[model samples]
Structure formats: C-alpha cells, structure tokens
Target: MRPPAPRRTTALLAGLGLLLAGCTTAGDDAGPGESGLLTGPGITETTISLGALTDLTGPYAALSTSIINAQQLAVDEINADGGICGRSLQMVVRDHGYDVQQALGAYTEIAPSVAAMPQLLGSPMLAALLDDLAADQMLTFPQSWDSTLLGRPEIQVPGNTYDVDMINAVDYLLRSSLVAEGDAIGHVFFENEYGENALSGSTFAAEREGLTIVEQRVMPTDQDMSAQVTALREAGVTAVLFSAGPAQTASFVGVAAASGWEVPVIGSTPAYASQLLETAAAPALEGLFVMVSGAPAASSDIPGVRELVESYQSAYPGESIDGGVLSGYGVMEFLAEALRIACDQGDLSRAGIIAAHRTQGLVEGDLGMAMDFSDPNRPPSFDSYLLRPEVGADGGLVEIESASRAPAVDDYTFPTSG
Candidate 1:
C-alpha cells in the first residue's frame, strides 16, 4: 500500500503564482547608475534582474517548484535586507518544462534582458545552451554538475560534478563493506550527458577497486526497470548504481524488491524524490542511498539551514519542501555574493559578474558544502553527502554521512575544456 502525497496547501500554490508574477519584470530603458558604477543588461538604477530558467511542468516539476519557491524567498530576503548595491534584486523566471528547445528559446528571450541566470536546471538543456551563453557572456549557475560544464567562464557549477558524485558513492559502499572487491555492480543510467558523466566515475572506481560494472543504458523516457533488473541479476551484480530520474529509481528499487534482489542500491541526487515515499516503492526505498553535495535541508544542524526552515515555514505555513529548497537558496546566495563583489569593484556588467565570481575564495554558508570558486578550471568542491530515505523525515531523507571527498577522487583526473 502507498502513502498519500504530501500536503501542498492551496495557499502555497497561490503563493507560488504570486511570486512568479511579481518577480517576472521586463527590462527597463534606464542606463548606467549615478554612483559611477558601470552597468549592463538586467541592471537598472533601481533594480537588478536575474533570470531563472527552470522546469515546473515536467518530470522534475516537483523538485523545480521547490527550487523556484526558495529562490523567490531568497530574493525577498535580499531585497528586504536593503537590496544589493542600492538596487533591489528581481528574478525573471521562465519554465522550460525540461525541454531543450524550450530552454533554448527561453534563454534567447531572457539573455538580452537579464544580467545573469542563477538557476538553469537540466543537464541536457544546459548542454544545448552553452554556446549561446558564452556568446552573450552571461554568468550562469547551472543546477547540474556535469564535468563538461566545467572550465567555462560563463557557467559556474555549485558543487561536485556527477562523475565525482558517483565516485564518492562507490567509495562509500566499499568502505562500508556493502560491496567487496572483485564483485560485479550494475549501473543503470540515462544515455544523456548527466548519466554518461556519472558512468565515467563508476567505471573509474570499479577499475580501481578491482570490481566489475554491468552497464544498462536507458532513455529518459524509459520507466520500467524489469528488463534492466533481470539483466543485472543474471550478471550476478552485488550492488547497483543508479543515475536516472526519481521515477526510474522507484521503479528499479520496487522491481528489485519484488524479485527478492536485496542488493544495496546507490543513486545520484536526482534519482530520489520525497514524494516517492508515498508509493508502494516506499518500503523498498528505505534501503536506497543517495549521493548529494550538501546535507538534507530538513534535518541539518547548520545554523543557516535552521534559519531557512524557520523562515520557509513561517512564509508558506503548510507547504512541504525537499532538498531543492536548500539547493535553490544556496545557489542564489552564491550569486548574490558575486554580485556584491562586482558592486564593490564598481562594475555590474555581465563581464564584471564573471570576474567577481572568479575571485570568490572560500564559500561557506548554511545550505551547502564549503567551495572555492577562485578557479574555473576545477570543480568548486569534490565533497558529497550520503543520505538515506526516512518516511517521517522533513524531506523524506536523512544524512547518513556528512560531506567528504573520497581518497580515490584525489587520483581521478577531471576533464578540462577542449
């Protein structure tokens, strides 16, 4: 039997509508500021507009909606704190439905108007828009952590790349004695950049540990995991590494449980959704582990996380949230710091934003791992948090391990720009 979905109150939904409508402002015809600070697109004398290319009506809509709400909250808080550099922050949001074409169109429409984008979700969509982003010199913070997005002056990934995340997952399993050397583990992933990138990490870790990986590549549209599970079981895999969406994770784990395959399953951050706890797969998911960049928002002991939870609850009253809320809030805060730096340097142009980001030395905040944003050629951080699902937990997940970089990651070579 499945549990009921979390309660998303009507007031919460209405709040989201109001936030979107309020934040979506058109670019103004105003020019440079009176303070002698050079200004560019998205920045007027009174406001600084940022773009949010997100997904609200697609496979990851639940997560994206939480992210958007958190972002709105961050904007509200920043604006209330006297704004940045004498200008209020305004977010121009556009939902792309996780479609590449739609994302490109949205970027095209907003790129000329906004100074930068704080939230560009979807690996495939970001991959498609890379060239356009570079041409416009738009400073963007992608929600994805694909290695291919690294080393780009215009794009900044907030945490460990997908490959690094998978490597850490494998290390966690091996160290915890969940899997042994010379055993075979199954890897089920999408054929897209996100999945392929994760596969590289698993492949590297398997080779180093003398373990074998049985691969199962699936399309984004693939849902049922009976065939993949059957293949892995036949291959005698001792464990499973999953790098698909939440739906695939539930299906794989549910199917495995029904078939009596009790192997441990480790998945990337995107693979689990809190709402999955409501399904029949809930019991099966209790054994699943997820790798992420930061501690779960709902249960972290960090002071910032506590403040975020209090503020969110106070604002929305009865809305249920997930890790995306913390992620959204953290990424937006990172961008705000960069804007502060740019403002201090007397430049708020798009180029100025990128330059300011490169100067960020060590970033420590309430929502994520400590990262050094000083270099564009390397990942900001290699640490990952291991989490397990718990039904009564605030976000349906609890941190089993805090942020740590695996020893194997030290030897792994990150790919550089071509």
Candidate 2:
C-alpha cells in the first residue's frame, strides 16, 4: 500500500513553531522567578545547564557525535530565541568512552552541576548510574530504548524500543508475502538488553504468525557473524532479523553473501549505520532492509524535518545525515516541550521539568509522531517505516513503506524479559 502524502501533523507544526517562537520575543527574559521550591541542581538565575554523558571516543562515537550535534543545534536555536524561561539553555557534555566505570565517574562529577541530563549514551552505563540518578531525582534523556528504562520516571527514551521495531518488521514481511506462516525465521542478536528487546518482539510475532524462530546470540564485541549466518542457513530460515551493531551488520551481510545464503535481512534501528555503506561489505548490504521509527532525513515534506536538514547541511557541509542525527534532533524537541511547560509553570527546576513532562501529554514536533508522555512507561510510538538499501552514487535506504504498525507490537506488554 502506498503511504499518503505526508500530513503536517499538528505536532510537527507546533514543534517548529515553538522553536521559531524561541527566536521571537515570546518567553520571559527574566528567567524563572525565585519560588523557593527545590528546583534540581544546575539552574542559575540566568541559565539552565543540561548535562550530556556521551560515548564520544568509544565504539559508538559516530552515533554519539551526531546526537551531540543535533542537541547543540536545538540549544543554539533556543538560545538565539531568548532561551527557555528567559535563561539560556546550555549543555555540559562529558565523554565516557562507552565505559561503565567512566560513565559512572562522569555522572558523579557532573551530577551536582546540572538541572537535567538530556543525553545518557550507554545502556549498561545508564543502568549503573540509575541508582544514583534516582536517589537525586535527577531527570535524564537516555539514548537506549530498552524497555527497562520505562520503569524509571526520570529516564525518557524518545523513541520506541527494539521490540517494537521487530514486531513491525515481522508484520511487514508477512503482510507483504515475503514470508509465509510456519517459515523458519532466524534472529541474530547481541544477547544484551538491546538485542533481547528486539527478540522479544520477533518472538511475539512468531507466536502470532506461526513462524519458527531460530535464535543466535552474540556479544557486544563480536564482529564476525559467519558462524551464525551458516547456522541460520542450515536451519532453512526464510529471513533473518538482526539486533546487533554496525560492524556485525556488515559482517552478517557480507558473510552471508560469501556463503550464498540469500534471504531477506531485516534489522532493528541500532543495526543501521551509514558508515557501513563505505565498507567492503557495502555491496553485500544492497537490498537489505531496516526499520526506522521516524521519517528519514531525506523526507523534507515535513516542515520541521526540512529545517533540521538545512541546519545540519549548513553546519556540517557534505556530512551524511543518518538515523543518529535524526534521533538527536528529536531528543531536543522532546526536551524543549518539557522545558517550555516547566517554565510556564514558573518552576525551572529538575522536579519542575519532570512535572512538566508528565503533564505535557502529547507533543507534536519534527521528531517523529506526536509523542505522548501521559504514561512515561509506555512507548511513544509503535509504528515504523521500512527502508531498503540502494548502493552507489544514488544509494541510501529509501522508505518503501510508511506507517507500518503491527498488532503484535500494540499488544505486547512492556518491561518483558526476553
């Protein structure tokens, strides 16, 4: 089915309008007034500082950089428009190098210095810091979409979890007749929360679609997936769903091709990395599909998306806009809504921001869909777009289908162990 002409959802228009409004003279330049309420740390009379603990020099460095850039763009724009509640929004970033101990140390050092943390990069690292964060009632914008984070009110993941992505991917395959009922479907996962989250969805789909799921788990450090691909092929699987990193993605596709195991390969969001397109495995990745929660950066039909693309292009001329960049931009939009609501309530503190997030039920912006925070424990959206890879001068993953929402996803319970 063809996707309808992209409608400028109210959320999209409102998000851009709010950002543009910041550029106008609408907010109170006097900043949040002294209400004597215990606002969280990091808010001064003139500025609201946000901390970002990232993986700048780690395995996921490229992704971390994109997110940082997007967040910076939002901050710059917000600051130019007079900032939130009359105070400049500043982000204090720390690179943890994807090490849990370093991440904990970074959080310890910066915990007392910010009003909120809008970017906590690693799942394991974030998990290690959760206790400390909760003790201080600190609000965080985590990068991982693991369902476990949903239980923490202070941690808000901007997009759906890996489980939701798999559910939709499976549904797409079945609906499109690429796979039949009872066909053997294999899953190559990382064996961690990120991988398991995706497996949970695929498992759910299998139970509903009557497909057999052959599981193959790998460690986060595993770079070669030849053995796994060989096993899946022997099992006579009709397709493979992946929940691993970029290197693993390349390895799986390249190795599969070398072994002559041709099957539709679908990956969760984290499985995609534009950098893979430049690798020796690039040719092997042709025709591979991945799930994307938001509209791609290439889709300029939405006004907010257009603004983001233009901003990124001008700022980083010639740089590729990938999912990481798009995700980072989305995060800021989510933060902006929460901050705006808090400022309106005359409380720019950490507690104030949390309260604002809970009350700001549905926020429509350029992020993806209208995000609803009415229940922080639930996913913001269960739908996704299916993207297929095309190599060469005009190569990139193009959206072949939009608005693919699976019933299995909608019915799947949150915080399930896989």
Question: What tens digits encode model 2's per-residue C-alpha lDDT throughout 56-78?
Answer: 99989988888898788878877
Task: Report the alpha-carbon TM-score of model 1 versus the true structure.
Answer: 0.91
Off by over 4 Å in 1: 1-32, 295-297
Highest-lDDT candidate: 1
Tens-place lDDT digits, model 1, residues 1-418: 0111111111112232222222212232333466667677888878999999999999989988888888889889888788889999999999999999999899888888899998999988988888888877788888887887877978998788889998998998899998999999999999988899999999999999999999999987999989999999999998899999889999999999898888788888888888999899999999655545444546777666777877877777777768888888878888888788678767677777777667676767656567778777788889888888888887888888888889999999877563
At residue 139, give the lDDT of candidate 1.
87
Give lDDT per model, in order: 0.80, 0.73
TM-score for each predicted model, relative to the true structure: 0.91, 0.88
Off by over 4 Å in 2: 1-38, 292-300, 391-395, 416-418
Q: What 10-residue stretch in candidate 2 is worst by lDDT?
A: 1-10
